[model samples]
Target: MTVLALGLNHGSAPLDLRGRFAVPLDALGERVQGLRQHLARAQPEVAILSTCNRTEVYVGLPALGASACPRHAMELAEPAIEWLAAQGGTAPAELRHHSYLRAGADAARHAFRVAAGLDSMVLGEPQILGQMKAAVREADSAGALGTTLHQMFQRSFAVAKEVRSRTEIGSHAVSLAAAAVRLAQQLFDDLPRRRVLFVGAGDMIDLVATHFAAQKPLQMTVANRSTERGRLLAERLGAAQLPLAELGQVLGQFDIVISCTASSLPLIGLGAVERALKARKRHPMLMLDLAVPRDIEPEVARLPDVYLYTVDDLAQQVQANGERRQAAVAHAEAIVSAGVKSFSQWLDQRASVPLILALQRQTETWRQAELAKARRALARGRDVDAVMDTLATALTRKLMHGALSELHGSAGEAHQQWADSLQRLFLRDTA
Candidate 1:
């Protein structure tokens, strides 16, 4: 078994398809537990990183024997893929079509890149690191984190920090929140004159609302399922707050609406928008739905007076500005490459632990036997020098017994192989 990363991102899967697999952040722990039970035989260490842009499952399976090295990675990852598909209630084949799998060193490289935001929709966007940290916390809380995955993420965070500090990758980073504001600007010339309503007090809404606030919109209000949560964000932005129930009643009051919630269902329906549009006397409204499993219905985009943009639509706008940061991409990739190499070396060392332990145990047993014999000889009135010399001779013989036996038994190519191995193991120069 090996480390494997299996999932589909915005680039690999469409928005609608991605939403089907987008596990809510609050429910991540539960989903992880379910997957753990499903793969109990493998006893895999699992972490699910689910965000607006991607849903990835990282698993560190129990170590395999040298003979099992020939087994394919997908054979080990199939259980995870099936469990994930079952969670989404999606067809396994459909998930497989859009998903990509990374194994061993490749999985480590992918994790590092993802944490560094090199794999995000918006190049060098910093939010992914925080999202990754949140995923780690959730997985750890669910009792799914183990040595392999814990080390991988801790190293990933370090790499991300190095990439951000050592390079200017984030210098021109255009985040989805910033992209939403840019798209809204395109539809509405006077952002300062438009009243904005943010339908959610979650992280994404907080981000997008902050971007809109920078423009000093005419008025801003946060409408959330919980008035208390909405009020907190509203106070930060110096805006008003309203419970989510009043959204339809006051929806028309705001000219620009942004919604991102973990509702698992559309918060803004066609009828709600149609009613709001009619109340505005057909005045156009700019609505940005940054939520996966969408906060705004797809059908709402049909209304002539409303412009609806989802996360995918915003990603296109974000990508157009990605070329400006191209110069820094190479610098970030170099850091990630070094990180992957280091992690691979660490993994190799961990694999050698069993052999190392066995060798140490065997040598200790031989030493104990030689020491006992020397003590017995001394008790029998043997000369101290003779006993010491005899102990040294016996220990040397015992230490070289296996190598000598192998050399004596082998012939031709096999003899040469054993000879070379012994020379490297025992005859190598050490100062």
Candidate 2:
């Protein structure tokens, strides 16, 4: 089956639109299975990669017939867009404007580039590789990952590793965590004196906490609905856990706060931050909301002593380092190009599988016939050497007989083509 990749990303859509397309970790498998059902005729095998920067759907479909060679997998594309729109609870027309579709080698090439972090919001950021692996694992669990997708992802991962080891693609990288810390430094002269409170205990929160912890903040607390999960991350970071309910009450105690939670609504509002600022006697506070829906109210940024930054704000801070990583792009791209070529060659071999099997069966039949004749001759007391020689010559003649018959009947251009092919098959290097 040919491969197809379709969906929108940070480059093609805004964050608010992309957020609607985010698939929760718990629902990834079910979503993949649903997608497969949506395009069953196309032999849909699906894997979804959703992150802060993008949400892409990868599909595998049966190849077009010989008469339709070079045709796009547009049959799968329309139904897929409808299914994806429904899954995201968005209007099909709305998403289609920002969506994209890539077929055949282009789909595979896109995947390789993505896995190598060439398509990330932050150039060469490594986190997307882990996210992609998670998506692949989810799709496999749903029985939606078939041969084509399995091979594509496996090759994508290998290409990512090759690029990493062979070049400085990830060297001097700038991350969201680093961006948050850098912004915090701009407001506070000394991080050691600031009290920091981090909301949620997911990967993004963990990453941000690690960076902020490196500065050795005076007091750091992790707040979450589940104290058990919060404590696990807390103990590892040499920090303490706080009940999420206590966040509002203790907001005044922290000089800096960074939050990333999967809540449907804002965790901290303008009124709450205002109260905190009043409690602290107008002392400035640097706050960040890294979650998609946002953990802090947008109006909180309007407060005089409150510095609230969203994921978008942190992203802006990291773009300045893009030029440093651009030089290695060519090297990483060369590795990706070679990887695509290798994958294409492998795909071509897969297409030859049926023909190769038929050839093997034909040869076996001819072999069995020659063996029976040889056995009867020996049983009749004929010379063994003569029987063996006859068997060898007979088998060779039978094997070449089909090609010779076809060649003898061919004429003009067809005759010339068959003769050349026969010469190459039989004479090889001499041809």
For each candidate, how many residue pairs have backbone atoms clashing (under 3 Å)?
Answer: 0, 0
Off by over 4 Å in 2: 64-71, 274-282, 302-305, 358-423
**TM of each candidate vs. truth:** 0.94, 0.84
- State the C-alpha lDDT per candidate: 0.88, 0.85
Model 1 ranges with Cα > 4 A deviation:
64-70, 322-324, 408-417
- Cα RMSDs, all models: 2.2, 3.7
| Candidate number with greatest lDDT | 1
Expressed as tens digits, the lDDT of each residue in 1-431 for candidate 2 is 67788889878887677777877776889888888887887677899887777789998876742111333566657788899898778898988898888887788889999999888767778888898999999999999998888999999999999888888878756778988898998999899999999899989989999999999989899999778989999998999789999889999999989898777678998889989999999999999888776678888888888888778777777886453465688889999999988877777777677789999998899899899999999999999999999999998898888899999999999999999999888889885
Candidate with best TM-score: 1
lDDT of model 1 at position 229: 91
What TM-score does model 1 achieve against the real structure? 0.94
Cα lDDT for residue 234, candidate 1: 98
lDDT tens digits by residue: candidate 1, 145-212: 99889988999999999999988877778888888888888888899999999999999999998999
Tell how far residue 32 is off in model 2, in angstroms: 1.5
